[model samples]
Target: MADFDIELDASGLNCPLPVLKARKELNGMKTGQKLRLIATDTGADKDIAAFAKMTSNPLLDFYIDGEKRYFLIEKGAN
Candidate 1:
């Protein structure tokens, strides 16, 4: 896996918040940068994947540790 350039702890947030904040953060980042997003929202499983696809960002990895979910996403040129 690639090292993340930034980390966003969206743990405790729900649904769109996590994806929204991720989009906001990614907007400020350079292309090819990576984001490590830690979220507890169950909805993130689908939301994050859809958001990545919609924005052209690439989700590099994902895993669950108990209730916590981790997403590794790479910013794309789009």
Candidate 2:
């Protein structure tokens, strides 16, 4: 598991919801801080990665536990 500064549970949300909330959280976080996002939407695997890249935030790590998807995102200067 990766060390994270904050955690966001976007479980049950679909599509852009997870990404949108993550973006909102990341925007308030300082650079280099990591966010642990817990989501149930299967689309989050790709969506979160794309969102991270698009925002310049690094997707540090990702893993799965049953139906749940986990993403570790580190805030970027942008």
Candidate 3:
């Protein structure tokens, strides 16, 4: 179990909620910090990836476990 600087559980949330929460969580993190987002929404795969690309954040990892989608995003330079 790797410890992330920010852990956001967006399971059961709808589209935008996961992305929104991820953004907010990342906003409070310092540069180089990591955010782990756990989401159950299927759309999160694309949504989160696009969010990271659009925001210029590094998408460290993206994978699926059972019904959950996990995203590891590293905070980008300010």
Q: Which residue pairs collide in model 2, if any?
A: none
- For residues 1-78, what per-residue lDDT tens digits would candidate 2 score against the true structure? 778999999999999899999989998999999999999999999999999888899999999999999999999996
Native-to-model Cα distance after best TM-score fit, residue 4 in candidate 1, in Å = 0.7
Clash pairs for candidate 3:
none
lDDT of 2 at 7: 97
Give, for candidate 2, the lowest lDDT window spanning 10 residues: 47-56
Give the Cα error of residue 6 in candidate 2, in Å.
0.3
How many backbone clashes does every candidate have? Answer: 0, 0, 0
Per-prediction TM-score, please? 0.95, 0.96, 0.93
For residue 7, model 1's alpha carbon misses the true position, in angstroms, by: 0.4
User: Candidate 3 on 1-78: residue-level lDDT in tens?
Assistant: 355788899999998899999889888889999999999999989999999999988898988999998899999997
Cα displacement (Å) at residue 76, model 2: 0.4
Off by over 4 Å in 2: none
Prediction 3 global C-alpha lDDT:
0.91
Q: What is the C-alpha lDDT of each candidate?
A: 0.93, 0.94, 0.91
On TM-score, the leading prediction is 2
In candidate 1, which residue pairs get closer than 3 Å at backbone N, Cα or C atoms, i.e. clash? none
